[model samples]
Target chain A: MATGVTATAGTTRGRSRLRAALRVTAAVFGAYAFAWGIAAFGSALGALAGLAPAEAVTAASLLALLVLPVAALWAFAVPRAVMGWVLLGGGGALMTGVACAVRMALP
Target chain B: MSRVGGPNRGTPRKGKLISPALRAAMLWPHTWAGVTLGGLLMLVFFMGSLAVFAQEIDRWMMPATRVEAAGVPISLDHLSLDRAVRPVVERLAAGRAVRDWYVQLPEPRRPVMALRVRTDQGNAGGMATVDGTLLPPVGTLGASSFFYPLHYSLHLRAGFVGYWIVSFASVAMLVGLISGVIIHARIFKDFFTFRSWGQVRRSLLDLHNLTGVLVLPFHLMITVTGIVIILPIVLPAGVQTLYGGDIDRFYTDALGGYERPRTGIPAPLAPLDPMVAEARRLWGGGEPAVIFVHNAGDAASYVRINRDTGDRISLDVEPVYFDGVTGALLQHRRPGPMVATHRVLSGLHFAAFEHWPLRWLYFLFGLSGCVLIGTGMLHWMEKRRVAHGVRPGVGWRTVAAATCGTTTGLLIATLAMMLANRLLPAAVPSRELVEVAVFFLSWIGAGLHAGVRTVGNPPWSGQCTAVAGLAAACVLLNWITTGEHPVRALAGGDWAILGVDGVLALTALASWRVARRLAHRPMRMVAPTNAEVSDHA
Candidate 1:
């Protein structure tokens, strides 16, 4: 009975550790992806709004830098790790896709 | 910024901006990021601080460059660049055909003109006095080539891996800073709080918070600007979307740089003085700082002159390109508004202006960053010691070793390298590499010592003593070898040596005092109870 209890405890500890690792991974890379999406979308949108390509890129990049830290901090503030991942990582992908589409649609 | 009711479920505490759960969550990234990357941050900050005086340090190390006329800026109008400078470039090319060459004009801080030539054989560089007499190679990479590059690149050039790592740490630092401010309940109160006579833990926390809150703006500005300087390289999403990911093309467009392919037909280059005069005229009177002759000895050669940026807060030189044969203005390009804004931001970080007070503030604020990171790690170690009881765990020991290695160990390595520069034979082949090797080897040695001795407090006092002694030795050796003692240096008007030696002396004194204090008060570990020990077993 004691052995079984200890084994369960060990498994629980391992699971929590794995969850923590996943959260950290999401916080770092997911936030990075989100920032990338911001940069891409902002630049493409700026270009479509008749700004020069270089100007749009510079302005977008500056804005992206501001977004990165907040996104990273927000990743941890969210209650569920999976929610953070889905929102950051998934939102990043969707935005990046839209950016690429917009670029393709450009004259 | 405060979130309202959520799944946190914690009782709302009075006067707290953030929920307890949010604060706790922020603490994880803050603590872990500081622990893991604090060593690298310390290195970057310290190296950057040193890089602020890179030119001065270069003068200290390369004594041959301690020109008596250092403070006097050489006039481009008075010097015949084609007559005096061209022969030096030709000599550097030797029998090989000249590809291209550039000359960095003598400034007040650096009295010698630095010339670099790219020949068909390879590349060669030598310094010349204001009168264009070629001096022998300084032989050492010195601060500009080594420490300044190490600040941003970590000397890792292959695939920009160093830049990526540094940028990642910078982002982590930004995260740490913002999260830190969010979590700190009384940042304003903490700004005025430093209880140095209190317990080490409290004092470390106080110092950490004090430095963090005090220089927070500088830390943020420096980090953001540093990142902005290399944004295209680190985050290429915007570049990829707009410019098809061609960083070179992006820079050419963004910075208004001009270049053209070289023609094989040989052509005699026109006088560079005319080009400098034309560039200055085009800029409505600005000093020509660097003159670049591209495609040398070719029909397609063009001369580009960059205006001095010392008087302004923009890194833009307002480069004016001239035809090599005709010396006629080819392209005088100016950056657009957004690019100009980027240059201004970059200039803030570069701090290449002539304000000594601002330069010293940059240095001090930079060192404050080091103090912040150092105290943060110290606070962590102390906090963990209280929790973990008498004997430190493996995790604690590792952090302790790294803290020692990056803090005092870094100082030891830098001082030892400077000492090596003084002691190494002047004619030693690859003396620069030897100095660098000394730096790395000493750093490794210090790390190993810390690792081995981490079982008992990580040898902080001993390492401090070593730093004190090594720094003193460096100053002494410089005097003994170069015959330029601080007093003599001042008398002879060599402010560079005087400044370097004076800092070294101060370092020695401060380190010695710290060593004594640390030795007197060894870190106290909480004693584990017998019951607790058995419970662990």
Candidate 2:
């Protein structure tokens, strides 16, 4: 009876640890995606403007697209990815904020 | 008593593997999380899938309008801005209380110059020839305009409820997808394997998993983009904190300056033809889709040109402001780095710039997502039958009915609504309301039929019949109402309408085949197994 109780207790502890690890991974991935999206948008803009280093800007945009799925998959495995996810989400929020600001400031 | 004669005599059973308390905790989260949000997710996927062909549907439904591209080069030479400005202003001010006015020039597919004026009471717009004679108000509810908006915003009471519902569904979908992947670690190995003739449960599981795995990338992209699409609404608290709670101000800065109305006194204006010609010089001869005139009949009046080329998503032509009287080019508003990025993202999400080929691909992907959601629901019901240790009860039955009704019934309802469009009187009061009523009524009728008639029978055959019937009706109705058979329409170069009918006929044929197969199948009565359990879970 004592052994059975100990075994159940050990399983519960292991699950709790796994849950914590996943949460942390999600945060890190969210942050990475957020930064990547902003950078990608900037590069795309540079490509449009016919500015210096145009080729590099185009390359960066393509890279961002390729990496997005990988980062999302990583978020599923590690809790740290959550940070990156949150960061990307936060960036989207910022862009939206800027849009709203521009709308109001205009005549 | 002999052990052979006991109740457990012939059984080779193991003891319970999981404690009751632990099982309850684990199962509670899975059941409530899935059941609570499953219906809403189904609605989002189904509507979004339909929205993939929104533009094509628009072309099919509004067949009365005709546009012939005039390859006339826009020239500023001998143009008079005076004639165009004075009349539009006088007409707009005289007709109704104005909120905003938009003017669009002739393009390849839409040759008539269009003016959209939103009034205090409701939205009203008109298209006219170059000479300014008004055309009849176009009928037929543009599924692209109505359904696309409703897909994301649900077109509910002011779109608030719809947005909230979609946001919640997105979050739930994210959770479900994550848990589902973790549960099925061997997802890739069996990616291409599908056995249609397996045990009932295994087949169901296979369908759910196959659809989910095959369209996994599309599902993720759509879900993430959907959240990104409404980032502002979801995180308004942060914006309010940073921007002093003035939402409009924030938008103006983000989107660049709003076109401010000119304070200068009114003056005689030049003809619009000259300004259009000037715009063409800058935009390289592409037909302008929209022409925004700022400060009409004033010294500061500016005309912004938006081209309608099929390749580029963004209207990249610079806004060319002109003097109303002099027709001299004024300041141009060029797009900066950030603005261009915003436009590209918007274009991708809306599929605004896609050709027919890419649009069809989007349609297929969207339909696959819908199938994924529908099969997910079916898998849930199958899982519950095994887990509950009881015969499928009223709750399971209700979900089954709803699943059949909402997924297949929605397709049926759409066809019925299209049929109603042709048969109903054009001048009937509240035509939109009547059309909506027909749509809902048909859907409700389908649900009631499925619930009563297919309680014990396999639901797939009934659903297949319903979908096939509606699709067949759609084809027939198109022929009867339009007075053009598919072959005749195709030969006459009316491809859009004919294509719509052909697609519906093909869908009908496919559904009929599925129904026939279901009817002939011998092993249709067995309960589902664990493999299928994981498909839905």
Candidate 3:
């Protein structure tokens, strides 16, 4: 009985540590990637809407900075660490792809 | 203190906006981030506070610049920019073909105009009085050049690695602040509560919360604007996407900057006073702070004059460009709304406006940020001391040492550098580098000492005493070398030097008192109560 309890506790500790590390990684890199995507996509959309290229970039960069910290904190707030990775990382990739397509489509 | 009516009593988690689970999750990041990056934040805050008075410190360090122009307005109209400044620019070129040149007009704080020339050989610069008489090299980077850069850049300019690191820490700081606000949802209830005479742990926590809550707005604004100033470089996705990775082009478009390439055909440069007058008229009355003549002696040369931004809370200088040969106005572009907003944010962070009261408030609030971070770390160690028992572990000791090294050790290093500046001979090769070496070497020594002594306890008392000694020594050395004591400085109307001396004296007194208290106070290891234990958990 003692051995079983010890094994369970050790497993729980290990699993929790891994989850914590994942959350940190997702918070830092995932949030940054998401911010970058927002900047790129927002800039492209603004330019398409008739704003000057520089103005679009400046406004989009400001928006990205405002979103970055909230996204970083959200990674920690979520129930499952994997959810953070999927939402931030996957969504960032999708937005960036669309932004690139828009850039290529521009005259 | 009725549980029914009191805020945060009994149902601590009830009616709170932030859920318990979310708060718990945030706690981890806040604690770890503050712990890991708190030292760097301390350096940034302390150096930034000092940088508020960077020009004054420059006057203190380089005594040659303490010119008597306190109330005398710099009348550039009467002073010939061509005769007074052009000769200095040409002299700085040293017979080498001048590529470009710029002159920073003297203000009240800095009475000596600064001029720099880029030549085929290299870049050379010098300081000259408003009347055009060149002064000897001060042979020191001083505060404006060294401390200000250290605050933002950490002196690591290669590929802007320092900017990236500072930005990362700033983001972490933002995270910590948001989490702290959530954790202390009832902060408003204890807005004015400060029980400094109570238990050390409780008092430290109170001070931390007090400063954190009170100075939150300033901290938030300062940190955000600091990041905004370098946003394009640190987060360049938009720039890369829109401008094809050319940051300069984005800046040119966003900031309304104008430039032209050299034609390689030589032409005699036109006089500069008219250009300055024209720029003033274009702006409807503003001082010409900086005049840059690009592609000097070329047919395509153009002069850019930036208006002084001291009177406004916007970093935008409204640069006016003119043909260098004809002195005719060429370009005067204005920024769009978004760009204008960016300039205002940058201005708030730069605090270059001529408002002494606001500048001092900025300095005080910046120091409060240092206090906030320092007290947070101290609170953590105090709470952990009981858990670690009589003999603390390596991890605990490491934090204690780092706290000491960053707080008092940083002060020691700064004071040591100031002392070295005064002591080093004028003719010593690389005198500035020698002072910088003194700063780093002393800081390392203090850090090593903390590491060794922290086995039993942090070497705070010793380091504090050393800080007091070094600060006092710097003041004394300044008086001895420059013969400009605080009293003499006052009589001479050199308020800049007087202010530096006054701050140094206060630092000495404050450190001495703190050291005495630390020496007398016994480290009591109180048994951890249920509340304390659970707080850490």
Q: Per-residue CA lDDT of candidate 2, range B209-233, in tens?
A: 7877887777776676675555445
Task: Name the 10 consecutive residues with the lowest summed lDDT in model 3 chain A.
Answer: A1-10
Task: List the pairs of residues colliding in candidate 1.
Answer: none
Q: Point out the higher-scoring one by TM-score: 2 or 3.
A: 3
* DockQ per candidate, 2 decimals: 0.42, 0.05, 0.39
Q: Count the backbone clashes (under 3 Å) in each candidate.
A: 0, 66, 0
For candidate 1, the TM-score of chain A alone relative to the native chain A: 0.88
Pairwise TM-score winner, candidates 1 and 3? 3
| Candidate 1 share of real interface contacts | 0.56
- For model 2, how big is the iRMS in angstroms? 15.9
As for DockQ, the candidate ahead, 2 or 3, is 3
lDDT of 2 at A84: 40
- What tens digits encode model 2's per-residue C-alpha lDDT throughout A6-85? 43466665654554444334433453444344434444344344543223232333344334433443343332334544
lDDT of 1 at B315: 92
